[model samples]
Target: MPIYQLGQINTAALQTPGLYVQVVPPRTRIINGVPTDVYGQVGVASWGPVNSATLVGSPTDAQNFFGVQQVRKYDLATAIAIGLQLGAANQRIVRVTDGTDVAASVALKDTLGTPVTGATLTAIYTGTVGNTLQATITAGTQQNTFKLTILRPNFTPEVFDGISGSGATFWANLVSAVNNGLSGIRGPSQLAVATIGTSITAPNTTNTYTFAGGTDGAGGVTDSTLVGVDGTSTARKGMYALRGTGVQVLNLVDLTDSTQWPNISTFASGEGVYGFTQGPVGASYSTVSTSLNTAGVDDWHMKVLVGDWVYWNDTVNTQNRLLAPATFLAAQCAAQAPHVSTLNKRLGNITGTQRVAQNQPYSGAEIGAIVGARLDVISNPSPGGSYYAGQTGRNSSSDPTRNGDNYTRMTNFLALTLASAFGYVIGQNQTMDLRREAKSAIESFLLTLQQQKMIGDVNGGPAFSVQLNAENNPDARVAAGYMQADVQVKYLSVIFYFLVNLEGGQTVTVQVSSKPR
Candidate 1:
């Protein structure tokens, strides 16, 4: 085609083995050098698809995929809303239904104690929230006309009117009507994987359909549920559903629950997934801060935000201080890709966004950092308000070599992400070209990070460097089909304290002093 369209063309065809000519533009590969901004969230939504992950890009997507705020059901929805409001531009939510692979569904029943035949109504999801649903059938003005009302949680009653059961499109239209919702209903969905049929005749008598058998297992979510029991089984639901979902971070919002957060965090870390979580909601801010600022079981593969203040709607904004941290951290990470530190920053400000102060309602010792438990909330001099002041989960307990500061974790995550991508690209390359290509890719990635100030600026210096070549991959090892990459990272430090002493009102000028005078 090119030969026929152009007078002359110099192309790769008929070229020597060592050289070629081409006109195609080079394809640039752009990938997140750190954990991608995509957030993988797992929650027990009162209404929405269950046991599967649904992609949600906006607040509306969140509402459509998961139910709106219910006093007992906002475990997932609230965090997602806060994340979006803060900065999560892309996200996915996994609505957990029951322990194991069980689906906690509700079924409509008839007067005879048996499930009604035809026009079956199942909640869009399987959970206790299904109990809130109320479906009713009533008479219409015209003959053979019937009105179907679906009263869903947090949504207006959906009334399907002027139904002619005689038409062939009856079942399809009825399903469509239920799916699209009536005038007032929008978010709280009635049909999760629910279905309705055409076999039932028009209602000559009024009947109300109610569902039963929804359950929240006493054991919380079982271990096998979050991380699939095995590879092939869909029984491993929730976070496991995020496998091919393209999310680099999995934010489990409830750190206090001791059920979902710990299990999900362990799974994420084991799979090289990076994310953030809120401090364990203890009795006070001190305990929460201590849990986050120090390390033990709850601190690996993810960072912890140690504050109990968040902004939701003003009416009961202060009601939930623990739920917003994962979202706040997620938003910040998304906005400043790989810059996961949200310390000393304000989260949200709109009327929909409420400002929650630290949990230091009684003692200000930890708040002012007088006790020096990592970083605590002090008055924000620049912003004229208060904000969190620490961005790390590292403490005296964690390893100093691999993770030492907030920036160090981000750096490691960036390097690892780049390395993962490099491995894939190199797998396609010839064995002989592995070292050269891998080195170049890694070097370019680190260079970009340095230029963007996402990581510390250490040259081939002891602080930061990546080495891959013949030295690390010897001819013997190359022959054995082995590849290795050596990486070292060190982050810069900040001065958090400066002691100033006034000795007996001396007349000496207090100017430019790093020493204790």
Candidate 2:
């Protein structure tokens, strides 16, 4: 028996009697739920490919990809570290710079007659992390040859052995070894690259050289650098680098520019992401509310935290630094399911806040005012308990009906899941069978979500309803190349306010009832 591949074949043409089998695709596509915990951050970093989205799942991964977090503003690694501390499992970080970064470099002198500069070795990536790299030149095991060793902190040393030549030829051989690789010993150097100098002699001395003059270029980094450009796939920069990176929650590290919140909101809406932003550090609650109101930043996809920068233990720099709350909030929210609300949920890894560190927590009036303004706040004593937790789950949306974090997350999750899952149905002919198949796929997926309690039944009706019959998808519309699947989903509401009715005074009557067996 011969098995045939997928295609339209004439079975009648097969004259020979044989058992032929052809595998047909599934009648309906299977719809899998998209992940809701991939956090994306764009900020400055010590070392890494700039304008690229790199996956860093833990602090160790982040340290390896972006170097250690520096004690400075807009540190991408630090934000990632904090997020990891707060249970951010999956993260895609994009490093940005101010265009003035310089790679770490060192000069190696020629060992013949005159010990002039023979070649210059430069770090492959720009940042202060490159300064930790060291290059050593020593005698090789082979006769009339030299060996070069490159060492970096926490990494195995790379050794290029048996480099033989004289003057410029010798330098050229060394540079080629570092840039490319030896035949079988190792791959190309990951730390630095070498450039040969003109009219030089061979390096014949054993000397260890330290790299220097590496700049992170963070001082000149501006808001535009963080927002980035989406010119093209090859030229995307900053947050744009995170496009289509499967990021459910997005944050710009410690960005506090309210002027750009609108732009971020728009991006989040288009990308099906929940964006986290912050107000200015130490700004009063009234000020933040006024600023947001005036800017008209009432976006359902945007969550604006205000007036509560917290002091986090920056173990990387051995200091307690005051940082914005957006990164931490974004990570915590991303760790949760789409239907879960962050309101009253305890946030971890917080030492102190601007309000609490000064012995001034948000008063009841202040909390009410801030929440009323459609902004979120984090405090030590929240309604849930005494541990640090979100005061409210409000997004920047002015509409009260669409303001909760749960609403934004659940909406994005459903919309994006449907959008991704239904693309396979686009080219299929509009028939009752096709419509039924699509409807079945969608209902099965939604039923799973309902069983998981991501959505729930409302008013004795189903949690969701799908309409794909001729009534909704008219013959004229189907003939005009339009196939529609009308869907209505009822998202579970969050309990923001709990009402308790109590009457226990002497004037109140108490009744005893029989208990169930």
Candidate 3:
């Protein structure tokens, strides 16, 4: 018998009674534990690099990298706040700007009203904010030294002190001064880096220097324009550009309206391409579901679809408003992850009241949880609230599991880890030694899950089983290069109801007979 690739074979990869996979996305590396604080957030910046995923450390760093929040037509400030709330302590986020406009730098003219020969003040980025900036050159205490002060919106005067007279370092000096001054202040600035040619630095008697002809250019500014970049440019555009960045476990938080939703399915089918979505979908479950289906994808097409219509403490508005359909779902996940990190736990309902979350309806107030095939969150409402934390995974209506990504990810994680390990350690040999090594690894991993109370043999039987022996590896099949691993996990679903009947005044206490008539 000739050997066949795992996909080419028709027989069960492993003849177990549980779960297994015929094909696994190719994965080369397998690190045991998961990673946190790694997030990709895209939105508009008043000033900063565009389409580039620059890692930032703090809110100040965020302001430095992407400029202050300018309240664009489309905003993601809410997501940023939520991620921060969920443990942004040591996390470094990849910050990106959706803006594609050009920098507005124009010539600084001389005292005679003529254009200065050498330097021009360019706002560190492109946008209308640059138009609001004006630079003034004033004399210094020293003979040739001078100070250039930049007036900006909602900012104190940024005084670029100690500039030299010679035209040699004027541009460099100005750029350095602007950056230094900007950093010292908390408010972000449109004035960042600069370039200048030969310029007469003779201190002007009038403190203000004249600059002219600065325009933001005709570029996309609205929500669609911000997210519509096709990523053809090397720097790329919007979230589409971030598809291949290898920024693992994205959590796929959408801050830019709902535009971040549709294209996530297109993030390239890579083995490690795993993440979750907190669709700030400003609409209802049906709406989000309809959109995903119409786009030819389900909530579980490639990621977990967690439905939430509310987010806490609007960073921009400072109002704890409902997320409409759902927007801050990512934040909710982040806030609640410590309780259960995508384990087979249900979110039930975070809101403390029955049929309410955050003082709103327990879930959506109308529905208990989301219906149909996708995985969703809702308030159980019986004991106040508990997000139906039992079932978690992004599954479609056609899927019987009905669980969200928790279980699926477990199976996938184990399967892929095993598959990759087997491929690397065993090579092409389909022998008994190969089967033993694979089985050991699978059992060890499963045991760890059981110990953690994640999964187990609750029924006094194997909650899960792995099979990879002579039966699966027939004499005809072993030669072709296929080793089957039929593994199954008995996921424990959350019990929503427990029935008990009470016949009026019936008591079992010993005192009941003495009190009876």
Candidate 4:
């Protein structure tokens, strides 16, 4: 027998049962509302208590104690605990009512004449009234009854009045007068004042007064006041304006300094005014004054231009600093002439001899041309027409000399013309062919600059190439590849190729290469 041929077999270990037990002592009862002492033993058969016992044992011993006698005990603590549990499990019921005006001393009772307990009540008291009593009940038999009674308050309202009279009567009369005066005063212009009496009366004999019509008699006024005693001290006369039915009275108490009054000078005419005139040309003292008053003439004086001709002191003065309309027009025409001849002397050029042909006349077209030429020269003189023409000036209104209209038109024309001229110049200078070549050169130079900056070079050396290819061509592709390994030329490498279909077509062959960086 060969002993070396035997091999031993092994098995895994078996698991043991894990069983355990715990015993807790049964609760004891209270004696006279105090806890009572009880004894318990865990080993064989030891037990002495006045309460119930709990026993748990191994499966083999469980049957022996299954029929053992058990008892439960109770005291004050046990009774309270049981009562609480019963109350929590029982259903609750409630009732509510408004007791706004009930008396505080009333005793509440249920149907069985039993006083209810454990009840809640709420009361809301308002108005000029006193407090009230509110009651609630929570008895099992009478849960639906309620009572309420109101108490009187101790306050009352009082009317207010001043030295004038009762406030209510005064206010009533005032409102009536204001309503009746609406036709004369219009809207709310009449002051409202109430009187204590049924009708308003004028002041008494001791008071002095003035009347609306400047009259001085007693019977002439509808309602009047006693003015004074006669010369013989026999009779009294009315001196104040009468107060009558529906007559408005102002209360001095409410008067202030800001009251409005009628203006007396609403349409008065005076100096320092301007309007149409219909009189002699030069009248120092005429029935109607000149429309251009003192103020107007003063303003004209301040605005007079130098070298203006004017008529002053009944004589015309050339070279005056103030010019009326006629004189201003004459001066303008004279300015268009060429030159002034010397008076009573050796020969000289006559006026208008050397005047520019374009500005010699005062016609509309001539004026327009002269003004346009002047503006072009001063504001937008483009040297030899190389620079674009910006806005020189414009005539905005029928009256071309109006300052605001002229300024606005000039500004608009300037902006529009400048933009148009700029576009024209750019189109003429930057042709399509030159722009294309320039763009290509700029792209190449940027790429070279980026290379010199070593932005993407792995070896910290200048190496770059321009990439060129048709954007949408699928079969034909070209790329310029350059590296610092070849140092002869730093220009971009050029790679170009085309795809062609062969006869009896076969698989295509792709070509790629590298050149200078």
Candidate 5:
């Protein structure tokens, strides 16, 4: 007998086989759950590429990429800082601009006795942060040569040396050095780009140049800019840039335009993103609720907040700033597990809210109006009391069944997880074994979710059931290359009210057991 492995030979034709060791691989696949904590924030910033998604891990990372929080509207860094403060990590930040941004530039003069222009250096990114860049030219160790040093705050200086040339050649060499960079000594300049103008002689001493005329272009930014275009991959803009970034939760920093709610809701629905938005700053509950209703913002995927814009200590800007409720609510929701509801969860790093700062809390009627509108808010003296927490974690849905934060988020989480894990089964052979394997994979995932308490039993019944067999995939459907799966999951509900029934002392008899009472 010859040694053989599974799939290497047909066993029925192996009449001369010596030792057949067939290794059968496991067919049942384990579906891993997708992360529900990554957050996506889209807004204006002082620095960073526009319409591009960049992952930032901490407040410092956000500042490093997008600049520090500014005392202006539509500030992306401020929103990211707020999210980080509330324990949200793994954020995808996308910057937006008004399309009027200009890069900072400076002209170096040629040593033509009268000193004609030699080269112009411009920042690569179009923002005011480029204005802070400084370039210096100093005599190099090689005779009649110069060294170029580019500097920016909180970054390593890029230096290019060993310059030697004449006339236009000198400027070309310098430009090439800054643009194409040296092979080993240094890489391309991160602060600026250089274009050759005219040649210059080596400076006798050091001279520093500061960039000017850079514009942030944030002044003219409107709601449309933040909503952005979902053009082709290379032309995608604003929040659309976050596509395929796997950001489970998202928000447009301080976006209050009621007209764009449907657009954002559509994007969220299509992208499987759970989004947060807020009413206008200092807007009354009636105004917010009416505006939401009129705007047709009733999607379970979008959570709209009201009456909880907070006064945050803007330590970066050294001022008190009013932040949107979505900033805190979205971050808290992103930080939580998918099954955990945002209801009554304490907010972090908040100084005061509009209600708290004004010594005004929502009355029963006001809360009723807000909840009746299916909007959520962060306020003090919540069910948790004293500390600020999400007071009624409702999404903007008229349907009461899908209004809860847990319902929306858990559904998205489970659905996305299944969709993400089941794609591998598409091209497999249409056999009962394949169907069984697919069924087992889905059942295994649901079992994991149930064991983790993400889903739960209802009245002693199983938390979920999945059907992916010949019964669901009948002869007609299977002949047409259609495989069907029927799944039903019971999500654990949030406890909005804990009611107690009490009987009169004189009429009721109390029973006590010695075990604990």
Candidate 6:
């Protein structure tokens, strides 16, 4: 009669006479349009004859199968960027005090507030009355303004509740926030850029010359006589020019030596020829001069050239004055924004926030509560309770086992149920822990890198790759099958990227993947 329909046979005939069967194993059922098993028969039963005409099966199992649901990977890059933003926001909350006009009229004070001349002063004030100064006689002496300035760091939370958002978008917004916060800080007047050119020859020594004028020798009879007098002979004694006018020259002499000049006694014998008549011996004196102009055009050109060089050199100072303030603000904002964002992100996300709230300690009470809730749901009369209804007969009222199969299948099924219920929670928690460690390491690296000033732009920020060893963790372990089949979970690898920008434009990308451990 109806071929002894063994829980509704799938085929008209059975392939084997005896095999354990149900509508189908829950694991074999389709979920989210994907068959749970890649290659396996799902639903209905078959037994008895190889080809039986009376066997019948339900149409729903074959026609209405769905696919299994897939889990999502964590976004590490986004987490890092968010953390940085949080740090920035925290930094901004601290005040920055100005010391510019504090002592303009009172001969400036040192950082200690002791009155001093030509000194620089900088201080922060929280408005406590302990160190308040009294009014003085000077016009601007009552400069009791608050010295502390407060800035808000950049930070934003990622909205993961089926909303549209990304790490890059969040970072861009964070950068903008930081820039805005820092814009209020006063900046330097100029920014300087320096350049050096090729060198020229060094200075050396040179000489100058002079000459003497003279008269004819025959004219000495009345003035002095010219022995071989031509009609042009005349008597006079004067100095004559030996070198051209306005010629530049250098005179070389050894200050340490005194005997280099001619002796006066030798010169009086007329051999030195201070004066002589023209006949066999011509009247003349030896002297030296330079051709290069060392004084007129040369001195003027050198002085003008040096003055121009000095003027060009001053540009660097000017530039520094112009750009110092803006650059300082930009760097401060950049650093602060990323830190704030990171903190906020960690606090706002489900896994991250929960772990942080719980203070990173495992709570047995919390775990027990969750397990108790799950047990209650499984025992209650829900639509899916029939699968577990038979368990009530096998064990005590508090602990039940599967009816048909031994405790092995029953335990496996329970464990599977538990996993299905809390898999997300486990993954989230594990991810949070790994992320915390990764972030700490990254932050340390970033601090060091910033000091080096290695990265030039926001696009070139630091990145991290994390490999999580989560397979052996308590959250992932579960019993299965007759031989204690450990439900193995795949390892998750995450890459985190970071960026810093001066103009409030920064972005980062993170990619995550899973692999069997």
User: What lDDT score belongs to each candidate, Candidate 1 first?
Assistant: 0.53, 0.86, 0.49, 0.20, 0.85, 0.19
State the displacement of the C-alpha of residue 208, model 5, in Å, after optimal TM-score superposition. 0.5
Q: Which tens-of-lDDT digit does each residue in 1-517 have in candidate 5?
A: 4444546787778676377787776887999988899899999887888899998988768866788788888899899988888889889999999989899998887545677768899988888888998888887778878788888888778889877676678778889999989778688887788987755454424467889889888999987888899988889998899988888898998899989989999999888899898888888777888888898878999998884688888887899888888888899999999888898898867878888788888887777878898888788888867888888888888898998988878888888888898787687668888788888998999998888888986566789899988678889999898999999999988898899997777868888888952
Q: Model 1: residues >4 Å from true position, as ranges?
A: 1-35, 98-118, 127-233, 238-240, 243-250, 257-265, 275-300, 304-335, 349-385, 388-397, 401-405, 423-434, 456-466, 487-517
Question: lDDT of model 1 at residue 18?
Answer: 47
Cα TM-score per model: 0.64, 0.92, 0.61, 0.11, 0.92, 0.11
- What RMSD does model 4 have? 49.5
Error of 6 at 335 (Å): 28
Query: Model 4, 370-483: lDDT tens per residue?
Result: 233221111111222322111112211223332121232222222232223223223233333333343344345435434554123444555443332233212332122211
Model 6: how large is the Cα RMSD against the reference?
Answer: 48.2
Candidate 6 least-lDDT 10 residues: 303-312
lDDT per residue (tens digit) for residues 90-130 in model 3: 32343343334656565554544654545566777665556
Clashing pairs in 4: 101-149, 102-133, 102-149, 170-194, 174-193, 174-194, 223-242, 338-352, 339-351, 391-414
Residue-by-residue lDDT tens digits, candidate 6, 1-517: 2344333666666667665444432222211111111111001111111101111112221111111111101111111222232221111100011111121111122122332222111111111110121111111112321121111112121111111112333223222322232234432111111111111211011211111121111111211110111121132111111011111110110010112111211221111111110001110111000111111111100100000000001131222111111111111222321111111111111121112233442234432332222111011121233121110111101232211112212222223333343322232333444434433443443344344442123444333232333433334342321111222211111112245653433564544578743
Order of quality (lDDT): 2, 5, 1, 3, 4, 6
Error of 2 at 126 (Å): 0.5
Residue pairs whose backbone atoms clash in candidate 5 = 1-17, 1-18, 2-17, 2-18
Better of 3 and 4 by lDDT: 3
* Candidate 1: pairs in clash: 124-191, 124-192, 228-236, 311-354, 344-388
Tell me which of candidates 2 and 5 scores higher on lDDT. Answer: 2
